[model samples]
Target: MSRPLKERKLLVVAVVSHAIVHICELSFPALQIMVAAEILHNPAAYQKLGFAYFVATLVFGAMALPAGFLVDRIGQRRVLILFLFGAAASMILVGTAQSYLMLVLSLGLMGGFIGLYHPAGASLLSLATRKQGAAMGIHGVGGNFGLAISPLLASGLAAWLGWRLAFAGLGLLPLFCGLWVLVDRSIKVELKAAPEDTDNLDRPDPKLFLLPLLVLFLMATLNGMCYRGFSAFLPAFFKLKIPAGTIPLVSGLVQAGSFTTLVLIAGMVSQFLGGKLADRFVKEKVFTAIFLLCAPFLFLLSRLEGIALLLSATAFAFLYFANQPVSNALLPNYVPRLMRGRLYGWFFFANFGAGSVMSWIAGTVAEKFSLAIIFEILAAIAALTGILGFLLVRVSRPDKKPEV
Candidate 1:
């Protein structure tokens, strides 16, 4: 039977909400250049700001387990609403900050709220749809679009108005979205038990789960490190590479932001395509191929300059983000529906929490060695992730049913 209209509406709203969260979450990276110039005022001071960003990211990662636990106790809808409202308020607070300490505090608060999005949002989407790969792909498109637009929007607003107004304005989106979700009675929020409530469901075989879980965690951590490290410095890297006279239509700031936006746009297409591929093929195989392909692009990014640099970065981003939906889809195959929230939380803890540390490392490397080295390291990480993906393919048997 066809899905109900209400179910489709829930998917749209959930996707849109996920997009808003990404916009808020990614705004800082896009605005970092302007923030460095206007607020910090020292080239080296960006590393200090990077430290602050790291702290916020650490919180974003650290809170996932707790957020998952809360989702299990309360419900996905309630947790999602809290994430939207709380994240919006935190963005507004970030805009109003005047000092470095205030900015750090505001960002940390925003990270905490942003932390609630992945586990709850992913769980909600998983429960709402059976086409896990396609659903994750559609959901990922929302997030990728947000990632694509945030830089452009932040830069334009910063150029026309100011960075503060940019942050404050973006805050309104999630706030309004949260209110809409609150009153929408059609979206289901209660948790349901597994279909098979047998003893085997209650106590799953450790051998079936343990090895695959470790592989997933390792791959997630590596992917997170590469993603966070590369993104944290992409704006700065482009700013240094792009000549001041290349784009006269706007200021250098806007040009840099535009480049970042262009690179991320490739992710939108790749996410959708990757999701479709996951459904048609073995998800582990698709995941492994994407990671393997990404390494060469990272190496190319390290060597290229100007237009070549932009093209290479775009290719790299396409491969890097394509894995998102594949991994999200693969999770349900191994995990039971009822425990998905907490499992997703743990996965994100590796992805975001451990991965967030890359920002600090990238910053340090940029300060001491060179930004190019960071990409080289990322290339190695991507290759390693591919190896882990292959291992996952061997360990995760397709014939097994999900255990509670």
Candidate 2:
């Protein structure tokens, strides 16, 4: 093959591999409701399962900093391989768990492995291409593809073969992919941070990033909390809200899975559209608009039921996911290239770490009060994120002009 063609092919492999990582990352949430029903055997046990999920997600976010540092020391390719192998192993452990403690332990391990993906993958993509926004959007679309399909795939597997086998079956994809990565000599990509730019020698300020980092942190935290809380319980929410006999064609599991799929399908489209918008317009403005639009849909989610609930949830998911690529694309513009991994590390620390807390809180609230209340709170969080997005625009300026 030609050189450019070969390179493009390798990039596609990287992108698709990233997608598979996301599939594994999200498979738990997709299967959590059924797993709770089957294993815990109590309706209230979902809250406990939520806590377990939080532990895993907390580890996922907490480990990102170390993972980022490792990416800087080792090449992104090696880290990707580690993530694939470790994630596959974690999934198998989860599938074979015989008790709650084992399940949580396995999930926490899975989270740790999944944590390696974003910081390392994002840094690699940025280094691979100059059109950072477009690249991020494409990358985001890959993740959304995983997120979109995981629920449906997991649900179908759970129905056909049981949840344990569902995980075991899904685990094979990453196992094969990791082996391919281990042996693929044609795939030659390595990324490291560039040395600090010396052009600003006279203007050196060690604290230059403090304010921008703070804004980004708050923005990521709020957005993460909203996203994680809403998504973590969506299947259960649909299961509870959608009346019996509403759709006679399929089982309840299938209906809930279909609604989840619909929401993620909207998210997939939004990721692509958001990528284009991020590449074209001011990313901060795009983020602000998307978050602002999200609040109403979230509110509608709390109040609506049946088809209205489905539509509003889809709208909410679209806006929630649309923010991802824009926020990711915007981050590198503010930090040094060499520090991108660490920056993403801290960024996702807020994103998933804070989000983990929100998941637990949502579960507690659902146990104490009602699931509908969580959406109301999420709406408020979305509004706060919109305000922060505007603040981010005011306090932070990009280091370079837009690529396209």
Model 2, poorest ten-residue lDDT window? 192-201
Which stretches in model 1 have alpha-carbon errors above 4 Å? 189-204, 399-404
Q: Which candidate tops TM-score?
A: 1
Model 1, range 269-300, lDDT digits (tens) per residue? 99898888877887878889999998999988
lDDT of each: 0.82, 0.80
- Distance from true position, residue 93, model 1, in Å? 1.0
For model 2, residues 1-404, the per-residue Cα lDDT tens digits are 55456446555766787788767766777778767776787755657877888988888888888878877788677888888899888888999988788888999998898888778887776666556677777788888888878878888888899889999988887899889888976655544323233324234664455676788789898888897888788877888898756778677776777788778888888888888888788787898899999899999899988888999999888887988888888777666766778888888888987777888888889988999999999999999989888787777655444545
Model 1 alpha-carbon miss at residue 139, Å: 0.4
Give each model a TM-score: 0.94, 0.93
